[model samples]
Target: MTDSGALQKFLDGVVVDAAVFSLRPDYRAVLLPVDGLVPGPSDEASEALLQAAEASAREALAGRTVEDLPHVVAWREAYKSFGAKPQRTRNSLEALLRRAEAGLPRVNRLTDLYNAVSVLHQVPLGGEDLTGYVGAPRLVRATGAESFDTVAGGVPVVEHPDAGEVIWCDDAGVTCRRWNWRQGRRTHLTDDTTTALFIFDALEPMSDEALQTAADDLAAHLLRLGPDVRIVRRLIANDMTHPEGT
Candidate 1:
Protein backbone atom coordinates (compact mmCIF):
# COMPACT_ATOMS: atom_id res chain seq x y z
CA MET A 1 0.00 0.00 0.00
CA THR A 2 1.12 3.58 -0.64
CA ASP A 3 1.83 5.83 2.30
CA SER A 4 -1.34 7.74 3.08
CA GLY A 5 0.44 11.09 3.16
CA ALA A 6 2.16 10.48 -0.15
CA LEU A 7 -1.04 9.40 -1.78
CA GLN A 8 -2.84 12.48 -0.48
CA LYS A 9 -0.06 14.71 -1.73
CA PHE A 10 -0.28 13.18 -5.18
CA LEU A 11 -4.02 13.73 -5.26
CA ASP A 12 -3.57 17.30 -4.07
CA GLY A 13 -1.51 18.10 -7.15
CA VAL A 14 -4.35 17.14 -9.53
CA VAL A 15 -5.98 20.15 -11.11
CA VAL A 16 -7.90 21.31 -14.18
CA ASP A 17 -6.59 24.60 -15.49
CA ALA A 18 -8.84 27.61 -15.74
CA ALA A 19 -8.40 27.71 -19.51
CA VAL A 20 -9.88 24.22 -19.78
CA PHE A 21 -12.81 25.09 -17.52
CA SER A 22 -13.39 28.22 -19.57
CA LEU A 23 -13.83 26.04 -22.64
CA ARG A 24 -16.41 23.80 -20.96
CA PRO A 25 -17.86 24.99 -17.69
CA ASP A 26 -19.91 21.83 -17.34
CA TYR A 27 -16.88 19.55 -17.16
CA ARG A 28 -16.27 17.35 -14.12
CA ALA A 29 -13.58 14.76 -13.54
CA VAL A 30 -13.29 12.04 -10.93
CA LEU A 31 -9.72 11.10 -10.02
CA LEU A 32 -9.18 7.79 -8.35
CA PRO A 33 -5.77 6.70 -7.04
CA VAL A 34 -5.93 3.05 -6.17
CA ASP A 35 -3.39 0.62 -4.76
CA GLY A 36 -2.92 -3.03 -3.76
CA LEU A 37 -4.22 -4.37 -7.09
CA VAL A 38 -3.67 -7.91 -8.27
CA PRO A 39 -2.62 -7.64 -11.89
CA GLY A 40 -2.14 -10.40 -14.46
CA PRO A 41 -3.18 -11.56 -17.88
CA SER A 42 -6.86 -11.53 -18.67
CA ASP A 43 -8.62 -14.67 -17.53
CA GLU A 44 -12.12 -16.07 -17.49
CA ALA A 45 -13.40 -13.51 -15.00
CA SER A 46 -12.24 -10.50 -17.00
CA GLU A 47 -13.50 -12.08 -20.21
CA ALA A 48 -16.94 -12.49 -18.66
CA LEU A 49 -16.92 -8.81 -17.72
CA LEU A 50 -15.97 -7.87 -21.27
CA GLN A 51 -18.79 -9.98 -22.67
CA ALA A 52 -21.28 -8.27 -20.39
CA ALA A 53 -20.01 -4.84 -21.45
CA GLU A 54 -20.37 -5.80 -25.11
CA ALA A 55 -23.96 -6.74 -24.47
CA SER A 56 -24.58 -3.47 -22.68
CA ALA A 57 -23.17 -1.51 -25.60
CA ARG A 58 -25.29 -3.45 -28.07
CA GLU A 59 -28.39 -2.76 -26.04
CA ALA A 60 -27.64 0.96 -25.86
CA LEU A 61 -27.10 1.13 -29.61
CA ALA A 62 -30.04 -1.08 -30.54
CA GLY A 63 -32.11 1.56 -32.26
CA ARG A 64 -29.60 4.39 -32.35
CA THR A 65 -26.10 5.18 -33.55
CA VAL A 66 -23.21 6.01 -31.26
CA GLU A 67 -23.43 9.67 -32.24
CA ASP A 68 -27.06 9.83 -31.18
CA LEU A 69 -26.16 9.38 -27.51
CA PRO A 70 -26.39 12.66 -25.60
CA HIS A 71 -23.19 12.10 -23.65
CA VAL A 72 -21.32 11.33 -26.86
CA VAL A 73 -22.75 14.40 -28.55
CA ALA A 74 -21.56 16.54 -25.67
CA TRP A 75 -18.10 15.08 -25.97
CA ARG A 76 -18.05 15.66 -29.71
CA GLU A 77 -18.85 19.30 -29.20
CA ALA A 78 -16.17 19.47 -26.55
CA TYR A 79 -13.66 18.14 -29.06
CA LYS A 80 -14.74 20.59 -31.76
CA SER A 81 -14.43 23.49 -29.31
CA PHE A 82 -10.69 22.79 -29.26
CA GLY A 83 -10.37 22.65 -33.08
CA ALA A 84 -10.35 18.86 -33.28
CA LYS A 85 -12.49 17.07 -35.84
CA PRO A 86 -14.47 14.74 -33.66
CA GLN A 87 -14.99 12.20 -36.43
CA ARG A 88 -11.29 11.91 -37.14
CA THR A 89 -10.08 12.25 -33.58
CA ARG A 90 -12.67 10.32 -31.68
CA ASN A 91 -12.87 10.51 -27.92
CA SER A 92 -12.17 7.39 -25.89
CA LEU A 93 -15.82 6.81 -25.06
CA GLU A 94 -16.94 6.92 -28.67
CA ALA A 95 -14.08 4.74 -29.79
CA LEU A 96 -14.87 2.19 -27.10
CA LEU A 97 -18.56 2.17 -27.91
CA ARG A 98 -17.92 1.72 -31.63
CA ARG A 99 -15.64 -1.21 -30.97
CA ALA A 100 -17.83 -2.65 -28.25
CA GLU A 101 -20.46 -3.37 -30.88
CA ALA A 102 -18.13 -6.07 -32.09
CA GLY A 103 -16.05 -6.64 -28.93
CA LEU A 104 -13.83 -4.81 -26.48
CA PRO A 105 -10.07 -5.27 -26.37
CA ARG A 106 -8.77 -7.62 -23.68
CA VAL A 107 -5.46 -5.98 -22.82
CA ASN A 108 -4.88 -7.35 -19.36
CA ARG A 109 -6.64 -7.92 -16.08
CA LEU A 110 -6.30 -4.31 -14.90
CA THR A 111 -7.08 -2.63 -18.23
CA ASP A 112 -9.81 -5.09 -19.19
CA LEU A 113 -11.64 -4.42 -15.94
CA TYR A 114 -11.61 -0.65 -16.39
CA ASN A 115 -12.59 -0.85 -20.07
CA ALA A 116 -15.57 -2.90 -19.04
CA VAL A 117 -16.56 -0.32 -16.45
CA SER A 118 -16.19 2.45 -19.00
CA VAL A 119 -18.49 0.75 -21.49
CA LEU A 120 -20.98 -0.34 -18.85
CA HIS A 121 -21.21 3.16 -17.37
CA GLN A 122 -21.03 5.10 -20.64
CA VAL A 123 -18.10 7.26 -19.55
CA PRO A 124 -14.68 8.17 -20.92
CA LEU A 125 -12.28 6.48 -18.55
CA GLY A 126 -8.46 6.34 -18.53
CA GLY A 127 -6.15 4.28 -16.33
CA GLU A 128 -2.42 4.86 -15.84
CA ASP A 129 0.37 3.30 -13.88
CA LEU A 130 0.71 5.43 -10.77
CA THR A 131 4.39 4.69 -10.36
CA GLY A 132 5.20 5.69 -13.95
CA TYR A 133 4.01 9.23 -13.41
CA VAL A 134 6.77 11.74 -12.84
CA GLY A 135 4.42 14.14 -11.07
CA ALA A 136 0.74 14.65 -10.45
CA PRO A 137 -1.80 15.01 -13.26
CA ARG A 138 -3.39 18.23 -14.54
CA LEU A 139 -5.57 19.24 -17.46
CA VAL A 140 -4.67 22.28 -19.56
CA ARG A 141 -4.71 23.67 -23.07
CA ALA A 142 -1.43 22.82 -24.68
CA THR A 143 1.06 25.36 -26.01
CA GLY A 144 2.26 22.90 -28.70
CA ALA A 145 5.60 22.37 -26.95
CA GLU A 146 5.12 19.28 -24.78
CA SER A 147 6.57 15.96 -25.90
CA PHE A 148 4.06 13.12 -26.26
CA ASP A 149 5.59 9.69 -26.81
CA THR A 150 3.67 7.39 -29.09
CA VAL A 151 4.08 4.93 -31.93
CA ALA A 152 3.83 6.06 -35.52
CA GLY A 153 3.93 3.53 -38.39
CA GLY A 154 5.06 0.86 -35.93
CA VAL A 155 8.04 2.89 -34.74
CA PRO A 156 8.52 4.84 -31.53
CA VAL A 157 8.36 8.59 -32.02
CA VAL A 158 7.51 11.78 -30.16
CA GLU A 159 4.67 14.05 -31.12
CA HIS A 160 3.39 17.42 -29.99
CA PRO A 161 -0.18 18.59 -29.53
CA ASP A 162 -1.46 21.59 -31.47
CA ALA A 163 -1.62 24.89 -29.68
CA GLY A 164 -4.88 25.30 -27.75
CA GLU A 165 -5.47 21.54 -27.69
CA VAL A 166 -6.88 20.21 -24.43
CA ILE A 167 -4.51 17.76 -22.75
CA TRP A 168 -3.69 15.98 -19.52
CA CYS A 169 -0.11 16.39 -18.39
CA ASP A 170 2.39 16.41 -15.57
CA ASP A 171 5.96 17.67 -15.25
CA ALA A 172 6.95 14.98 -17.78
CA GLY A 173 5.14 16.38 -20.77
CA VAL A 174 1.68 15.19 -21.83
CA THR A 175 0.12 12.03 -20.46
CA CYS A 176 -3.05 12.11 -22.54
CA ARG A 177 -3.85 14.16 -25.61
CA ARG A 178 -7.09 15.66 -26.93
CA TRP A 179 -8.79 15.27 -23.60
CA ASN A 180 -9.49 11.51 -23.34
CA TRP A 181 -8.88 10.75 -26.97
CA ARG A 182 -5.56 8.97 -26.54
CA GLN A 183 -3.19 8.19 -23.69
CA GLY A 184 0.58 8.52 -24.01
CA ARG A 185 2.82 5.47 -23.80
CA ARG A 186 4.70 6.73 -20.76
CA THR A 187 2.10 6.07 -18.08
CA HIS A 188 -0.07 3.37 -19.63
CA LEU A 189 -1.18 0.52 -17.36
CA THR A 190 0.58 -2.84 -17.61
CA ASP A 191 -0.03 -6.40 -16.52
CA ASP A 192 2.14 -5.90 -13.43
CA THR A 193 0.57 -2.66 -12.31
CA THR A 194 -0.57 -2.74 -8.69
CA THR A 195 -1.13 1.00 -8.25
CA ALA A 196 -3.10 3.06 -10.74
CA LEU A 197 -4.73 6.40 -11.47
CA PHE A 198 -8.13 6.46 -13.16
CA ILE A 199 -9.64 9.53 -14.81
CA PHE A 200 -13.39 9.71 -15.38
CA ASP A 201 -14.45 12.58 -17.64
CA ALA A 202 -17.98 13.91 -17.68
CA LEU A 203 -20.05 16.76 -19.06
CA GLU A 204 -23.67 17.88 -19.18
CA PRO A 205 -26.46 15.27 -19.48
CA MET A 206 -24.43 13.09 -17.15
CA SER A 207 -25.45 14.06 -13.66
CA ASP A 208 -23.20 13.94 -10.60
CA GLU A 209 -25.50 11.31 -9.18
CA ALA A 210 -25.00 9.15 -12.25
CA LEU A 211 -21.26 9.67 -12.18
CA GLN A 212 -21.17 8.63 -8.55
CA THR A 213 -23.08 5.50 -9.40
CA ALA A 214 -20.52 4.61 -12.03
CA ALA A 215 -17.67 5.23 -9.63
CA ASP A 216 -19.36 3.15 -7.01
CA ASP A 217 -19.72 0.25 -9.40
CA LEU A 218 -16.08 0.44 -10.48
CA ALA A 219 -14.91 0.56 -6.87
CA ALA A 220 -17.03 -2.39 -5.91
CA HIS A 221 -15.49 -4.46 -8.69
CA LEU A 222 -11.96 -3.29 -7.91
CA LEU A 223 -12.31 -4.37 -4.29
CA ARG A 224 -12.50 -7.95 -5.45
CA LEU A 225 -9.23 -7.68 -7.40
CA GLY A 226 -7.06 -7.95 -4.31
CA PRO A 227 -7.27 -8.75 -0.63
CA ASP A 228 -5.80 -5.40 0.46
CA VAL A 229 -6.95 -3.02 -2.26
CA ARG A 230 -6.90 0.57 -1.05
CA ILE A 231 -8.52 3.49 -2.82
CA VAL A 232 -8.54 7.29 -2.46
CA ARG A 233 -10.73 9.43 -4.69
CA ARG A 234 -11.52 13.10 -5.27
CA LEU A 235 -13.76 15.13 -7.51
CA ILE A 236 -12.52 18.25 -9.30
CA ALA A 237 -14.90 20.76 -10.82
CA ASN A 238 -15.35 24.54 -11.05
CA ASP A 239 -11.71 24.95 -10.08
CA MET A 240 -12.31 23.38 -6.68
CA THR A 241 -11.38 20.00 -5.23
CA HIS A 242 -13.47 17.95 -2.83
CA PRO A 243 -12.15 14.94 -1.04
CA GLU A 244 -14.23 11.84 -1.59
CA GLY A 245 -15.55 11.54 1.96
CA THR A 246 -15.40 15.19 2.93
Candidate 2:
Protein backbone atom coordinates (compact mmCIF):
# COMPACT_ATOMS: atom_id res chain seq x y z
CA MET A 1 0.00 0.00 0.00
CA THR A 2 3.03 2.21 0.04
CA ASP A 3 3.85 4.62 -2.76
CA SER A 4 6.10 3.50 -5.56
CA GLY A 5 7.39 4.23 -9.07
CA ALA A 6 6.79 7.89 -9.89
CA LEU A 7 5.30 8.67 -6.49
CA GLN A 8 8.15 6.94 -4.72
CA LYS A 9 10.75 8.58 -6.91
CA PHE A 10 9.33 12.01 -6.30
CA LEU A 11 8.96 11.54 -2.56
CA ASP A 12 12.32 9.75 -2.46
CA GLY A 13 14.10 11.23 0.52
CA VAL A 14 11.02 12.48 2.30
CA VAL A 15 9.38 9.90 4.52
CA VAL A 16 6.28 11.29 6.09
CA ASP A 17 4.73 9.45 9.00
CA ALA A 18 1.01 9.78 8.47
CA ALA A 19 -1.29 9.79 11.49
CA VAL A 20 -4.36 7.77 10.56
CA PHE A 21 -7.54 7.04 12.46
CA SER A 22 -9.36 3.74 12.16
CA LEU A 23 -13.03 4.34 12.87
CA ARG A 24 -14.86 1.05 13.12
CA PRO A 25 -17.75 -0.09 15.22
CA ASP A 26 -17.04 -2.43 18.13
CA TYR A 27 -19.09 -5.10 16.45
CA ARG A 28 -17.79 -4.31 12.99
CA ALA A 29 -14.16 -3.24 13.07
CA VAL A 30 -13.89 -3.38 9.29
CA LEU A 31 -16.41 -0.61 8.63
CA LEU A 32 -19.20 1.41 10.17
CA PRO A 33 -22.54 1.10 8.44
CA VAL A 34 -24.55 4.25 7.77
CA ASP A 35 -27.67 4.39 5.65
CA GLY A 36 -27.07 6.36 2.50
CA LEU A 37 -29.51 9.02 1.29
CA VAL A 38 -31.57 8.42 4.40
CA PRO A 39 -30.63 10.55 7.36
CA GLY A 40 -32.58 9.58 10.50
CA PRO A 41 -33.55 13.21 11.08
CA SER A 42 -37.10 12.31 10.02
CA ASP A 43 -37.45 11.20 13.63
CA GLU A 44 -37.62 13.41 16.69
CA ALA A 45 -33.97 12.93 17.57
CA SER A 46 -32.79 14.08 14.17
CA GLU A 47 -34.95 17.20 14.21
CA ALA A 48 -33.65 18.16 17.62
CA LEU A 49 -30.07 17.80 16.42
CA LEU A 50 -30.61 19.98 13.37
CA GLN A 51 -32.36 22.59 15.46
CA ALA A 52 -29.55 22.53 17.97
CA ALA A 53 -26.88 23.27 15.34
CA GLU A 54 -29.00 25.98 13.83
CA ALA A 55 -29.53 27.46 17.25
CA SER A 56 -25.84 27.29 18.14
CA ALA A 57 -24.78 29.20 15.03
CA ARG A 58 -27.42 31.80 15.56
CA GLU A 59 -26.36 32.26 19.16
CA ALA A 60 -22.65 32.29 18.38
CA LEU A 61 -23.14 34.99 15.81
CA ALA A 62 -25.90 36.73 17.72
CA GLY A 63 -23.76 39.80 18.28
CA ARG A 64 -21.35 39.51 15.35
CA THR A 65 -21.77 41.49 12.17
CA VAL A 66 -21.23 40.23 8.61
CA GLU A 67 -17.80 41.79 8.35
CA ASP A 68 -16.88 40.53 11.78
CA LEU A 69 -17.75 37.00 10.77
CA PRO A 70 -14.72 34.72 10.32
CA HIS A 71 -15.83 33.12 7.13
CA VAL A 72 -13.69 30.57 5.24
CA VAL A 73 -13.90 32.46 1.99
CA ALA A 74 -10.17 32.95 1.84
CA TRP A 75 -9.51 29.31 2.65
CA ARG A 76 -12.04 28.12 0.10
CA GLU A 77 -10.75 30.26 -2.74
CA ALA A 78 -7.11 29.58 -1.92
CA TYR A 79 -7.47 25.84 -1.30
CA LYS A 80 -6.98 24.68 -4.89
CA SER A 81 -4.05 22.40 -4.29
CA PHE A 82 -6.03 19.56 -5.83
CA GLY A 83 -6.28 21.75 -8.93
CA ALA A 84 -10.10 21.72 -8.83
CA LYS A 85 -11.71 24.86 -7.47
CA PRO A 86 -14.93 24.47 -5.51
CA GLN A 87 -17.71 26.65 -6.90
CA ARG A 88 -19.09 28.02 -3.67
CA THR A 89 -19.46 31.79 -4.09
CA ARG A 90 -21.55 32.89 -1.08
CA ASN A 91 -19.10 31.49 1.55
CA SER A 92 -21.35 31.70 4.60
CA LEU A 93 -23.62 29.44 6.66
CA GLU A 94 -26.64 31.55 5.81
CA ALA A 95 -25.91 31.48 2.11
CA LEU A 96 -25.43 27.73 1.91
CA LEU A 97 -28.55 27.21 4.02
CA ARG A 98 -30.59 29.28 1.62
CA ARG A 99 -29.21 27.27 -1.26
CA ALA A 100 -30.01 23.95 0.41
CA GLU A 101 -33.44 25.05 1.48
CA ALA A 102 -34.12 26.24 -2.03
CA GLY A 103 -33.88 22.50 -2.78
CA LEU A 104 -30.43 21.48 -3.94
CA PRO A 105 -30.86 17.74 -3.33
CA ARG A 106 -30.95 17.05 0.37
CA VAL A 107 -29.80 13.51 0.95
CA ASN A 108 -29.49 12.33 4.56
CA ARG A 109 -29.33 13.75 8.05
CA LEU A 110 -25.57 13.17 8.19
CA THR A 111 -25.02 15.18 5.02
CA ASP A 112 -27.22 18.00 6.16
CA LEU A 113 -25.64 18.21 9.60
CA TYR A 114 -22.10 18.12 8.23
CA ASN A 115 -22.82 20.87 5.73
CA ALA A 116 -24.47 22.95 8.41
CA VAL A 117 -21.33 22.95 10.54
CA SER A 118 -19.27 23.83 7.49
CA VAL A 119 -21.09 27.13 7.16
CA LEU A 120 -21.32 27.62 10.90
CA HIS A 121 -17.59 27.24 11.50
CA GLN A 122 -16.72 28.99 8.24
CA VAL A 123 -14.16 26.21 7.79
CA PRO A 124 -14.14 23.54 5.11
CA LEU A 125 -15.71 20.58 6.91
CA GLY A 126 -16.61 17.16 5.54
CA GLY A 127 -17.70 13.64 6.57
CA GLU A 128 -17.11 10.42 4.67
CA ASP A 129 -18.89 7.08 4.63
CA LEU A 130 -16.29 5.03 6.45
CA THR A 131 -18.06 1.80 5.61
CA GLY A 132 -16.46 1.52 2.19
CA TYR A 133 -13.40 3.68 2.85
CA VAL A 134 -10.18 1.67 2.97
CA GLY A 135 -6.69 2.04 4.44
CA ALA A 136 -5.47 4.98 6.48
CA PRO A 137 -7.15 8.29 7.05
CA ARG A 138 -3.81 10.05 6.81
CA LEU A 139 -3.23 13.48 5.34
CA VAL A 140 -0.87 13.13 2.35
CA ARG A 141 1.52 15.44 0.56
CA ALA A 142 1.37 14.24 -3.01
CA THR A 143 4.27 14.48 -5.37
CA GLY A 144 5.23 13.14 -8.78
CA ALA A 145 2.15 12.15 -10.80
CA GLU A 146 -0.68 10.19 -9.19
CA SER A 147 -4.39 9.83 -9.73
CA PHE A 148 -7.03 8.77 -7.16
CA ASP A 149 -10.52 7.52 -7.92
CA THR A 150 -13.05 10.01 -6.51
CA VAL A 151 -16.80 10.61 -7.08
CA ALA A 152 -17.39 14.39 -7.02
CA GLY A 153 -19.10 14.67 -10.39
CA GLY A 154 -16.78 11.73 -11.10
CA VAL A 155 -14.10 13.36 -13.19
CA PRO A 156 -10.35 13.32 -12.75
CA VAL A 157 -9.70 12.54 -9.10
CA VAL A 158 -7.88 15.20 -7.12
CA GLU A 159 -4.12 15.11 -7.60
CA HIS A 160 -1.56 15.67 -4.85
CA PRO A 161 2.01 16.31 -5.91
CA ASP A 162 5.12 15.70 -3.91
CA ALA A 163 5.58 18.32 -1.20
CA GLY A 164 1.95 19.33 -1.61
CA GLU A 165 -0.16 18.35 1.43
CA VAL A 166 -3.54 16.63 1.18
CA ILE A 167 -5.52 14.22 3.38
CA TRP A 168 -5.25 10.53 2.60
CA CYS A 169 -8.02 8.05 3.34
CA ASP A 170 -5.82 5.08 2.64
CA ASP A 171 -2.97 2.84 3.81
CA ALA A 172 -0.54 3.07 0.90
CA GLY A 173 -0.56 4.57 -2.59
CA VAL A 174 -3.99 5.80 -1.56
CA THR A 175 -5.68 8.92 -0.27
CA CYS A 176 -8.98 9.14 1.48
CA ARG A 177 -9.89 12.83 1.55
CA ARG A 178 -7.68 15.73 0.64
CA TRP A 179 -7.81 18.83 2.85
CA ASN A 180 -7.45 21.41 0.12
CA TRP A 181 -9.34 24.09 1.98
CA ARG A 182 -12.53 22.81 0.31
CA GLN A 183 -14.34 19.60 1.19
CA GLY A 184 -14.38 16.53 -1.06
CA ARG A 185 -17.63 15.49 -2.69
CA ARG A 186 -16.63 11.87 -3.29
CA THR A 187 -16.97 10.43 0.21
CA HIS A 188 -19.88 12.70 1.06
CA LEU A 189 -22.36 11.41 3.66
CA THR A 190 -25.69 10.05 2.50
CA ASP A 191 -28.78 8.36 3.92
CA ASP A 192 -27.09 5.06 3.21
CA THR A 193 -24.20 5.95 5.47
CA THR A 194 -24.25 4.36 8.92
CA THR A 195 -20.78 5.33 10.08
CA ALA A 196 -18.86 8.47 9.26
CA LEU A 197 -15.41 10.02 9.65
CA PHE A 198 -15.61 13.74 10.01
CA ILE A 199 -12.90 16.35 9.58
CA PHE A 200 -13.17 19.67 11.40
CA ASP A 201 -9.77 21.27 11.45
CA ALA A 202 -8.28 24.43 12.97
CA LEU A 203 -4.69 24.31 11.70
CA GLU A 204 -3.12 26.52 14.28
CA PRO A 205 -1.35 26.23 17.62
CA MET A 206 -4.00 28.34 19.33
CA SER A 207 -6.82 26.68 17.41
CA ASP A 208 -6.09 23.02 18.27
CA GLU A 209 -8.45 23.04 21.22
CA ALA A 210 -10.95 25.01 19.23
CA LEU A 211 -10.86 22.51 16.37
CA GLN A 212 -11.18 19.57 18.76
CA THR A 213 -14.15 21.19 20.43
CA ALA A 214 -15.72 21.97 17.09
CA ALA A 215 -15.25 18.39 15.90
CA ASP A 216 -16.81 17.07 19.09
CA ASP A 217 -19.69 19.46 18.78
CA LEU A 218 -20.15 18.41 15.17
CA ALA A 219 -20.13 14.71 16.13
CA ALA A 220 -22.84 15.37 18.69
CA HIS A 221 -24.81 17.30 16.10
CA LEU A 222 -24.61 14.37 13.67
CA LEU A 223 -25.52 11.77 16.26
CA ARG A 224 -28.62 13.73 17.04
CA LEU A 225 -29.32 13.82 13.32
CA GLY A 226 -28.80 10.14 12.58
CA PRO A 227 -28.54 6.82 14.47
CA ASP A 228 -26.34 6.26 17.49
CA VAL A 229 -23.06 8.20 17.11
CA ARG A 230 -20.34 7.71 19.67
CA ILE A 231 -17.06 9.57 19.22
CA VAL A 232 -13.63 8.78 20.62
CA ARG A 233 -10.61 11.06 20.53
CA ARG A 234 -8.30 9.83 17.73
CA LEU A 235 -4.63 10.63 17.52
CA ILE A 236 -2.72 10.50 14.24
CA ALA A 237 1.05 10.69 14.14
CA ASN A 238 0.70 12.69 10.93
CA ASP A 239 -1.87 15.07 12.32
CA MET A 240 0.71 17.86 12.30
CA THR A 241 -1.16 19.51 9.46
CA HIS A 242 -3.96 20.09 11.91
CA PRO A 243 -2.47 21.72 15.02
CA GLU A 244 0.01 24.58 14.89
CA GLY A 245 3.82 24.21 14.74
CA THR A 246 4.29 20.72 13.34
**Over the stretch 58-154, how does candidate 1's per-residue lDDT look in tens digits?**
9999999999999999999999999999999999999999999778998999899889999999999999999888878989999999999988999
User: All predictions: root-mean-square deviation over Cα?
Assistant: 2.2, 10.0
For candidate 2, write residues 1-246 as lDDT tens digits: 111232223222222333212210100011112222334534454445456556655665566633344434333433443443445433334344344333322446676666666555544455666544444354545554544555456565665434453444353344333443334445555556665565544322215445555666665655454343444333222332434322
Worst 10 residues of 1 by lDDT: 237-246
Candidate 1: residue pairs that collide: none
Best by lDDT: 1
In model 1, what is the error at residue 190, expressed in angstroms? 0.6
Candidate 1 has an lDDT of 0.90
Alpha carbon lDDT of residue 77, candidate 1? 100
Per-candidate TM-scores read 0.96, 0.54
Instruction: Please give the distance, in angstroms, between residue 203's alpha carbon in candidate 1 and its true position after superposition.
Output: 0.2
